[model samples]
Target: MQETHDINIIAWWGALLSTFLALVKLWELWNDRFRIDIGYNFTGAPDIGNEIFVRNLSSKPIILSYWELLYGSGKWPFRKLEEIESPGPDACDIRIDPHSSKTFTFAEENYFDWGLKTLKGRKIYMRLYVAGRRPVVKKLYG
Candidate 1:
């Protein structure tokens, strides 16, 4: 009877430890899922032709400092980064609430500096810089 009791106690401890470990793993997985979704849409407007969307998937608000456009001119093995200059309300001031999204539009005139007629029909990508986190990158066009 004493041996059976000892075995039961050990089994109880084992089950408790397993539960604790599983809880820790669940917490890690929840934290790992903290991220944002960034994408773009071409509006085809004559003046402002592009709209970029940012969605915060985490429970906290996400502040975006700025975003860059990545593109390759030729067969070169490298791409270039062009910082987009938002017209008003500096990009850094943009905040996205948890489970919410925001859109940014750029005027057509901005493309002149990139030597492109328009942002459409070109190989382009976006990289959004977030405070206290790694920059989020996504393919925009091409």
Candidate 2:
């Protein structure tokens, strides 16, 4: 009788462990369901100039708090950084509905004026902050 009781307790623990792991996996999936996609092009069009595209791939709407441009200096092992945040109250006003995208257009001269050319060919990255979630960062390569 004691042997049977021990076997039952072991089985109960095994089942409990499996259930906990499954719940953990479900939590990860839930967290990853909402995603934001970002892309940019530096080649200026005659009419539109350069553009950055922000897309929402989830089923829920998302509010953007702000964004920043990041560039680095120095070699691989040790590097310094500089950041240029989006200016004005408009930066915090962006919102994207589910399965939609928004394009931000700016002139080439504006890029130069923004001081992005100081590093000359250095790679740039964009960091976006969304309300109630971690920030997303991506390389700005065309």
Candidate 3:
């Protein structure tokens, strides 16, 4: 009888330890999932054409997969101003370290080629997406 009771107690302790270990592991995994910091600056319109520079200032590296530019206009339906192709493998993988910044030059010619006109004096919105993470959205009126 005593031996049986000892075995039961050992089994109970083992189950409890396993549960605790699993909880700790879950917490650690949740903590390391993903973290990001984003910053936006509206550089004045480009002199040569209607272009702007979007700067990313953050400590951790953010993998920007793609971005979209939209104009806020009141009408039957909102229109898409421009859709810039995300610089893929050829484009440098942006990794901004602490107190570091990266500049993305958006030119007007590219938009014109895509049948988009000047965005001057228009409210443009930018949406940036990173893989396996939430998108960082911003609105700029320049």
lDDT of each: 0.70, 0.73, 0.55
Better of 1 and 2 by TM-score: 1
Q: Which residue pairs collide, candidate 2?
A: none
- lDDT tens readout by residue for model 3, 22-43: 9999987776544443344433
Off by over 4 Å in 1: 2-6, 9-17, 20-28, 73-77, 82-91, 108-122
Model 1 lDDT on a 0 to 1 scale: 0.70
Q: In model 3, which residue pairs have backbone atoms overlapping below 3 Å? A: none
Candidate 3 lDDT (Cα, 0 to 1) = 0.55
**lDDT for each residue of candidate 1 in 82-140, tens digit (9 for 90 to 100):** 54553445544578889999887666676423325644445566777788878876766
Candidate 2 yields a Cα-based lDDT of: 0.73
User: For each candidate, what TM-score against the reference?
Assistant: 0.64, 0.61, 0.45
Q: What are the C-alpha RMSDs, in order, of all predicted structures? A: 4.5, 5.2, 7.6
Query: Looking at model 2, which ten-residue stretch has the lowest summed lDDT?
Result: 108-117
Report the alpha-carbon TM-score of model 1 versus the true structure: 0.64
Candidate 2 C-alpha lDDT tens digits along 1-142: 9999999999999999999999999987887598888887765353456677889988889988888767755556785557743655665567899999988776644452223465575666777888998988777751
Off by over 4 Å in 2: 1-32, 44-47, 73-79, 112-121
